[model samples]
Target chain A: MTDDLPPLLLGRLNHVGIACPSIDDTIAMYARLFGATVSTPPFDLPAQGVRVAFIDVANSQLELIEPLGPDSPIHGFLKKNPAGGQHHVCFEVADIIAARDAMRARGATVLGSGEPRIGAHGVPIIFVHPRDTGGVLIELMATPDHY
Target chain B: MTDDLPPLLLGRLNHVGIACPSIDDTIAMYARLFGATVSTPPFDLPAQGVRVAFIDVANSQLELIEPLGPDSPIHGFLKKNPAGGQHHVCFEVADIIAARDAMRARGATVLGSGEPRIGAHGVPIIFVHPRDTGGVLIELMATPDHY
Candidate 1:
């Protein structure tokens, strides 16, 4: 099926999502160890059931996500890992809908409602199932407003 | 303890390592699904006990690693996952020794013999323990030649 279609317009990695029990501790580690500047006061995403912050790196950002509550999506992961771990890796795409359609055409499974929803970045985003992505939950998000 | 020490010089992400049972299947999926152009032919890193390949993305690379044998370090990961999963995430550093020392000073545990070893990229590299890295095994490698 390798035909004349253009390659996926995946932009630079926006951020890597790390699920942690305490965003404060993680932020402290980055600050003390790497001198990373973190976005102030994590904001809660009730729809996503997580609180998120960003640690600005040289070229990209590291997203720290903490479960908002027991029913949070990342709560199960934190329960199993306790200390938490890499949750998902996000990449930027020029057009999220086109990316989703391309993935769907190739039989890739989009998670959740299988439609693009406004993500934490306030851009359209869709998650590809881990099974279809070699066990890594992959999130494709439209390029951020500033980018 | 944020004292009078220099911060770690972590460069842009070099790649995200994915441990896969079959690089061929993974490559095919990326090609068909994302039209990703993968580097041709997998290469063996005997010392690392894994076969590796790279899929170049717009800004970074996706490293695909497969166990070379039962003794392969990734063998255990594949056994647990059966399919495959994200194994590690690697970032480039300006200096290996400086980064190592900074991490050590900050109480981060360095894996292996506690010294940098030649990694798959033929550059000095060290793995930081997941315990100290928010449950994510982090690889710090000297910036590759020409990169």
Candidate 2:
């Protein structure tokens, strides 16, 4: 809040996650309309509870995630947004645990076990509860160097 | 869709538009949690039917839109998501008219008057109907060069 204090994280938007019931159809739509292509096909991350594919853009990427099982994390989101929509937004952080601590200290709620988990990128990440964020899920991933 | 065909646009994600009932509260939350400092501050755009502010990140930006008048374009969205949410994703296109024609040729509906209009960044932009983009609102703006 002060002009003298620098931001806690780099604040780089790594990706925007989209909850897709069908990743293949989403891929086709993006390509046919925007010429946006996806190279790395969808891969299942059972631990993460979804199948994800990345669509590269000039700076950030669009992450397409499809429910993998009945207990998929995005199941509720899809139930509400049946046509699929932006699910969450990911940002790069300097220190996963420290950022987590700082946020918690400020009365922010970190989703899950309140600890870092290996994200689909194999980087440590944590989700900030949307209730504290005006109903938008926020993911903070450790910088690649930290990983 | 093919390796040979490059995207029609720069594929740069211009910004993710967020419909906010109160931009002030959203700005405060971002700064408190992510330390996302928005230096330029919020300003009104009567013609666009909303007040706007840009939060800069590492690569892309997040746009906060606060409806201005009774018929503000975002009134319907706020009624659905009072806490606010990501409304649309924008990408940079090399040729607005060409891209519009291309998508129309493919049967994707372009919203508005089907012509480029000046966006908040003072760039020419148009919205692609959500029905065509898997229920996600997509905005295609003329790349800086074309603008």
Candidate 3:
């Protein structure tokens, strides 16, 4: 059954999201240490309740997500540790809808299994529950340029 | 100043380490969805106080690490969240020594820079602190069979 599947949605890693208490400090640290360049500047996502900034570190990207308001996911994460930390890893998919469907067939649950929503980097994205992927919060993304 | 360095490290993602409460479930989830076969079976790392298994998921890998003893890193992480989750992401490099040196030059504190320790796949690896990489745990690795 598994052999018949097109492929696993474990696609290329788009970026690793870092939850930070202060996006400015986080950006500075990565810039100084890894010489990471800001590929995507800070932008707000009211729907997701956060602002994000991305720095390209060689092959992978380093993303800094900070909650704008108290209701944001970052807000909840910060309560545990103000420093905030690693958020979720994003994987580039050929088709997010198809990926979600494939994952469901394998006993995985997804937050949104239909159309992709605009996420950081102007890409269509969907979130898969961590419970379904070994408790690792996974984001499936499909960049228009790639598609 | 950022452009002075001769591309500090060779660019490619190595793997993402996931701390799972149930290695069996994690293994099944990945294998069923991604066609990810077990590249390395579960093995106990008494020194690190953890048991680990590895699977190659496309160009990258999915590693399942579980706590075997109380002193293990997995144990501490699991205590924080019993559900288990994404642990760390490793970056592949051509030369570990050169990469470590570059990181140090950039003010990054390496966990074990001088010596490269053998990982689950028998590859040499070193960990970089989250404090230095924008609050994201980073690992640098080199495998003889990789390049």
Give DockQ per model, in order.
0.57, 0.64, 0.45
Residue B112 CA error for candidate 1 (Å)? 1.2
Q: For model 1, which pairs clash? A: none
lDDT of 3: 0.73
**Best-performing candidate as measured by lDDT:** 2
lDDT of 1 by residue, A87-118 (tens): 88899998888999888887889988777988
* Cα lDDT tens digits for candidate 2, B1-147: 567553545468988899888999999888877778775589888877989999888788899999999989899998988999889999988788888888788798998789888888887888888888888898888877532
- Candidate 3: misplaced stretches above 4 Å? A1-7, A102-107, A112-115, B1-10, B33-35, B93-95, B98-108, B112-115, B143-147
Residue A52 Cα positional deviation in candidate 3, in Å, after optimal superposition: 1.8
Better candidate number, 2 or 3, judged by lDDT: 2
Model 1 local distance difference test score: 0.83
Off by over 4 Å in 2: A1-6, A145-147, B1-6, B145-147
- Positional deviation of residue B56's Cα in model 1 after best superposition, in angstroms: 1.2
Candidate 3 residue pairs in clash (backbone atoms < 3 Å): A8-B34
Model 3 interface CAPRI class:
acceptable
How should the candidates be ordered by TM-score, best one leading? 2, 1, 3
RMSD of each: 2.0, 2.3, 3.4
Error of 2 at A81 (Å): 0.7
Chain A TM-score for each of the predictions: 0.91, 0.93, 0.85
